[model samples]
Target: MNNENIIDIIYGNLGSMTATDQKVAHAVLTAPKDAVNYTISELAKVAQVSEASISRFCKNLDLTGFHQLKIQLAKVADDESSYYDEINIDDVQQALTNIKNNKVAEISNTLASFTTPTLKKIMALINHARILQIAAEGNTYPVVADAIYRFNQIGILAIGAESWSTSIGQTLNLITDDVLMIISNSGESKALLKQIDVAHKQGMQVIAITNRKDSPIALKADQHLRTSVRQYVLNSDYYFSRVAAITAIETLFLLLIAENRKRLSAIQNHENIISTDKI
Candidate 1:
């Protein structure tokens, strides 16, 4: 079996292993490729187990400390037997179930690495902004649109305009009190970057949701919510990261909305008062 298969076996039978082996097994399962590059000491520390236990774990797989285990795993990862191409047609239920699992894993990882300070900053931005605008292009548009909807639901002066010129027009009177959240997976969209530059120049707080941390949009944004996606060819039929990015945006919006629950309730109550007065 290939290293991935072996890793799966290790994961599956983890509870059966000795307590020390379980630590090593968990580390490998979480990040097999990264584990290959770690030294014995590094791996042992990461696994929270001793070096001697690590060597014993490798021996369980018929290898030596860190290096030989890495070589074997690398060979398996590089081998053709481990490669699987996307199948266009599949049973709908099976496909959806697997996709759901993938999304859960991606969000879990994203949340784990998420910095608390970043979240606190985003929440502060939402709380203090006079207006919040979400702008996006291509598939990213859906995420921004949803954010705008959430903002409106809570009576925030939020806007998400689809067309390029309209968004620019809307931003003409922008001030530092405004905040802009831009969503782009690739972070290479020229128009979006230009708009972000405009917002920044006007002293607005710009937040970027993108996969590319080093992309121009990220550099220009006042804040960033970085998401990780598997690199694939441009023409690749099945793109897996769209949902992950969307989930990140949704999470951010939910957090912001939840944080402002009292304010939202007050806004609704005022609107209700006005409606009753008119009636």
Candidate 2:
């Protein structure tokens, strides 16, 4: 079946996939053109996934085998260029359409970067930690505030320290299992890097959400969740959209919320107390 929505399902299901299946998904989804030409073994190497994992990935997608997976990827590749264009020089009406497409693409691609296992690990860390320290600067601070608020809602003690620089002292004082989450677009901010190092030295579980998978923060953090996006520039200033990062945070927030019936009941009780929807 050459369902056109297959690619969307593939990309969007990354957070729900087994870590092994996620590897295969990331490999092909990252570069479908190269993937379409890859033999099963080659794809296995590229995705760092075993052949057995690929087969399982295929089956999960309801495909027969690797051969069928290749064919589907190829078919989807051929049809993809018809709509997914990067350049947008349209009138306002068409610009609306472009914005919609770009946002959808950003959200899809961001979600594609996560694995179910990693998200579960993050949930464990957050739930067990005595404090959740969020570090961000400039454009990323809004993300920190959102993270702290949501974490608080989930009954976790959390704060935004502007950046990790402010948390080093607290790290020495807090429980050893405190978690530090970083939201940075560049992931290379010198201050942030130093903070990551400090957190690590203090034995904190440090995680990062960044647009660059290879950036220092991503590489150095205990866990990295990526939200890389297509670049857009206008009037000589780069337009960096946080839509993907926001989606990633929301996904984590919801997953944390869904981790157990206890959380669900707590949320219900909490909502019963504070939410204005009672009217």
lDDT (Cα, tens digit) per residue for candidate 1, span 1-279 = 232334323432343468778778767655667777888899899999899999999787656556777876665454322222222235777656554555555565445445789888987897788999888886667777777766766667788788878988777778999998888866778998989888878889888877545567878887877664422223222243666577776777678767766756855776887797784
lDDT of each: 0.68, 0.73
Residue 150 shift from truth in candidate 1, angstroms: 0.3
Model 2 deviation from the true structure expressed as Cα RMSD, one decimal place: 10.4
> Could you estimate the TM-score for every candidate?
0.62, 0.66
Which RMSD does model 1 reach against the true structure?
Answer: 12.6
In terms of TM-score, the best-performing candidate is: 2
| Model 1, runs deviating above 4 Å | 1-93, 230-241, 263-279
**Model 2 bad stretches (over 4 Å):** 1-90, 163-169, 235-237, 272-279
Residue 250 miss distance in model 2 (angstroms):
1.0
**Candidate 2 C-alpha error for residue 14, in Å:** 24
